[model samples]
Each structure stands twice: as C-alpha cells, then as structure tokens.
Target chain A: MTRYFEDLEPGDVFETSGYTVKKNEIIEFAEQFDPQPFHVDEAAAEDSIFGGLIASGIHTMALASKLTVEETFDMIANLGGRGMDDLQFHQPVRPGDTLHVELEVLETTPSERHSERGYVTYEQRVLDDSDAVVLSLRMETIVRRRPEGQTE
Target chain B: MTRYFEDLEPGDVFETSGYTVKKNEIIEFAEQFDPQPFHVDEAAAEDSIFGGLIASGIHTMALASKLTVEETFDMIANLGGRGMDDLQFHQPVRPGDTLHVELEVLETTPSERHSERGYVTYEQRVLDDSDAVVLSLRMETIVRRRPEGQTE
Candidate 1:
C-alpha cells in the first residue's frame, strides 16, 4: 500500500474484477433508492421503452465504485474526489449483466497549496459482458504526495 | 406517482427529509467501497486534512439519491437518469452530519425521438444541518408524458 502520487504515471490503467448484476439486488436497490417502474416493477418495465427491468444508474455507479476499490484502488494513498465531469449513461444495466471497470489515468498534478496532497484525474468506464461501455465518467481524486526527499 | 411531463414546471422544488450520518456507516461504506485511510481509520483521519471521519463522496451521493427518492421522486413518473453533469463535492460530509436534499426542476423538454416520453432537467443539492451545500449535481431524468387528449 505504498502508492503515492509519485507512484502513478499519467498513462496507467486500473482495472476492477467482474461483477454480475443480480435481480434481487437490483430490486432491492431500486426499492430503497429509486423505485422507478423501469427499475422496480418487472412487469411494468416490460411495457416501458427500456423493454425490461434495468438497474438505476446510481446503482450501477455504486457497484462500479465498489469493484474499483476492491480490485485496484486499495493500495493507493487515495483521497476523496473533488468533482466529476461529463458522466454519461450509455446503456441500461440489465440483470445478469457482468460488469467490469477500467480507469485510465489522465493526469497527475501536485498541489501547490497543500504540501501533503495532489490530484489525479481519471477517465473511468464500466463495460458489460458484451464489451459495451454502459457508463463513462471523468473525475479527479485527491491523493497524498510523496514525502520530502522520499523516492521509495 | 402520477407525475407527468406536462404537469411539471421549471421552478418546482423537491425536498427530502433529513438523515443523520453515523460513524459506523461511514466506516462501513469506506471499508467496502472507498477504503481510504481518512475514511476508514479514525486516528488517521484525525491526523489528516479532513481533521475527522468523513463519509465517502460516493456515499454522500448515494444518501442524497436515496432521500430524493423517498421524499419526492417516488411519486413522480421518473423513468431513469440519462446522465449527470457538473457534480461537485463542495465540503466534507462528516459523521453526525444531518443531510437534506433538494432538487429544482431546471427544465422539461419533450424528446425529439420519442413521442411518449420527455426529459426533465434538474439541479440537485445536498445541504448539511448547518445549511452549507455539501454536494451539487445536475442531471436529466426521463419521464412519461400524459395521454394526448386525457389529463387523468
């Protein structure tokens, strides 16, 4: 877990393990947080434009977040995010869809005011089993920088 | 849940009940999804720039999303979110903070490609107990249109 701002390159790629969407979890999440017909009611969803039950976009993002930390970001000197730009839902996440995440580092900037931290920008994508990018997000995460005179 | 595109006005405001953040929940969410030292380890957090345990930004958004549904969106003809823009984390959401959500309808437009549905744009904000905005989000949601000739 020694990853600091100095440890990451601009072109680095971080990947998360595959996670399958389950019907019950979708329903549960939708029931508690969304409750849209397209998300909560299977029969009604079949009649909607979506054609069937689909996971809420927030749920999809949450799942992607969970997977990213589990597989890739666990070792970094990670700080919380500052903001997100240009987040899009490219497609519906359906039941049984196995989703995987990829985050490409776009830039790393050392903080001028905060000596202990910096920001890392990433373009993150969530793809279904068919390799379709269902979600695309761009965000900057604050991370601790390498200590003074410490390369290792 | 009788809301339709035709019934919404641009200045409409939707508000949700307040929710208090718990230390264990913050730790649990971070343990599973964010896992940053500042978010998981209380001692480390006390030493970190945040100066105390704070919820993950994603966790904050999830809570806001949940409250939005429970208080307002549940009764609306919400289809699902299309995307989000200009999502910002303005301040740290710490344990014991009470959060409340408000969404203002920015605009509503009929879909050019679809006859039965339309998009509703909203500016969403999550305010802490002290009335500071901790999160700001902008997104579009698809909603069903009322019948061509029938109001009910």
Candidate 2:
C-alpha cells in the first residue's frame, strides 16, 4: 500500500532493521568521499582523537537514508527530498557497530501551490547497537497526496 | 603547510576543480545508499516528477564533501566534521553534469575548553557546469590551533 501525504501524521514513528558497518566498506567510502585520516588510514587514526578508523559522517548519513527508504519511505508516495536541517554526528561509527534508524514524523504541510503534493518533515535518529545516537537530522521531503475520496 | 585554526579567517574562499558526474557511479551510489526508483531505475524515473533519473541528494552531499577535502581541507590540521546546517538541494543533479565546490569561511572560534583546538565554520556551495548552485550547506569542523610561536 502506498502511503500518501495524508497517511503520515505528526508523531508517527517507524523503526528499521540493523546494518553492520564493515571496515573495508568504511575505508572505501571514506576514500571516495571523505578520505580523512581518521576515516581512511587505521594507523593514522590511532594517533587522532578517534583512536581508530571510523566511518565518515557522510557515510553514516547515507546509511541512515538507505535504511529509511528500504523499510519505510519506499512505500510512500515520495517525490524527492527537499532538504535537511540540524544534521549532527554525535558518535563515531566503528567497523563492528550495527546501526538502525528511528524516524518520527514531525510535521506535514500541504503545499499551497500544488494540490497534489505536500511536505513531510521527519526527525531521523541513527542509533548504534548500544542505543546511543550516532547521528540525527531533520529531513523534509515532497510527498504526493492521495486523490480525493480515494480510500486505499 | 597545514592551515591551523589560527590561519583561517572569515571570508576566506576556496574553489575546487570540477568532478564529472557519471551515470554508473550515480546508480551505484543510489543502489547502495538510497534505492528510490527515481534514483536507481531509469525507466521508473521517466514516469516520476523529475522525468529522468536523478542523483540522490545524499550522493551530491558526499561529492561536495569529497571535493572540499581533496582541494582544500586536506591541507588543514583538521580533526573531523562537527555537523551541518541549512542543507538545501536547489536543483537535481544529472549524469554528465560536472560539479565543483566553493567554500567560504564563515566564522572561527577558539575552543574555550580545549585550548589546543577550535572551530571553523564554512559555507559550502556546490555548483554545476552551468554555474547554478545545486546544493548548499553550512558545515562546522574542529581544527587544531597553531602551536604558539611556531611561525613556519
């Protein structure tokens, strides 16, 4: 069932399954997108503040988005993302860490100019196995509205 | 010559070389991190609002970060990213489009608690070959302070 804009209510919550962070994957992503010592070079990371190789924050953000799409947003009438706000990286994600996402619908506003679409704001918290939030952000997306009188 | 916190001043601007966006890379990244049909499937994208496959916003963000790190941040005594705010994607990034980044230092603040480090805030604008701003964000990062009396 496709979830339209009207189907998402503020305070609605969703959880996604876990994804294990791999050392090689982290290095590969970092090399391609970040390439910082703490994220790519294990030996150099030992001397940095992290003390070990860690996943790039960008990688963490991507992982969070992936999980949300696979488990929740894939079923929605999502047009695309509008933007993000208040993006924060709270903890370093290590190679052995397993991560999951908790998504809360924060707001929904029907587009004044477009009758067929609306905006949905969600607070996404990416948490590690220990329940600590590794990353958090507020994401705004454009979603199609259900046709009038259509009950699916 | 590493650029320490003390070396960065507000209004310092750096422009990066361009990166050509490839169709295969876009699909591969979307497949791994954001498997929305519009981002990963070309045929499905034709029917979507965009009318074509588009790079995932997360992928664009990563590309911006990569360009910054490679062209500018690599020479800084950087610790790691703190966070980002006001992230906006103004336009959809298409395959074959080349992208570049412009980073402007916005603020610098010495860490009161950690004297050896401080924070540098920058406004990053990711532009395409047409000179349109596709993505923009405010990024904050921790940077090591220059050692006292070390003028090299």
Q: Against the true structure, whose TM-score is highest?
A: 2
- lDDT tens digits, residues B34-149, model 1? 77778899999998778988898888888888899877876787777889999999999998999999999999999999898899999999999988999998998898899778
- The superposed Cα distance between candidate 1 and the true structure at residue A95, in angstroms, equals 1.7
Residues B1-152, candidate 2: write the lDDT tens digits: 89999899999999999999999999999999999999999999999889999999999999998999998988889999889999999999999999999999999999999999999999999999989999999999999999999995
> Candidate 1 lDDT, tens digit per residue, A92-111?
99999999999998999999
Chain A TM-score, cand. 1? 0.96
The worst-scoring run of ten residues by lDDT in candidate 2 chain A lies at: A73-82
Task: Please list the C-alpha lDDT of all candidates, in the order they appear.
Answer: 0.88, 0.95
Task: Report, for candidate 2, the interface RMSD.
Answer: 0.7
Best by lDDT: 2
Off by over 4 Å in 2: none
Instruction: State TM-scores per candidate.
Output: 0.93, 0.98
Docking class of 2: high
List runs of model 1 lying over 4 Å from the truth.
none
Residue pairs clashing in model 1 are none
In the range A59-110, model 2's lDDT, one tens digit per residue, is 9999998999999987889999999999998989999999999999999999
In terms of lDDT, model 2 sits at 0.95
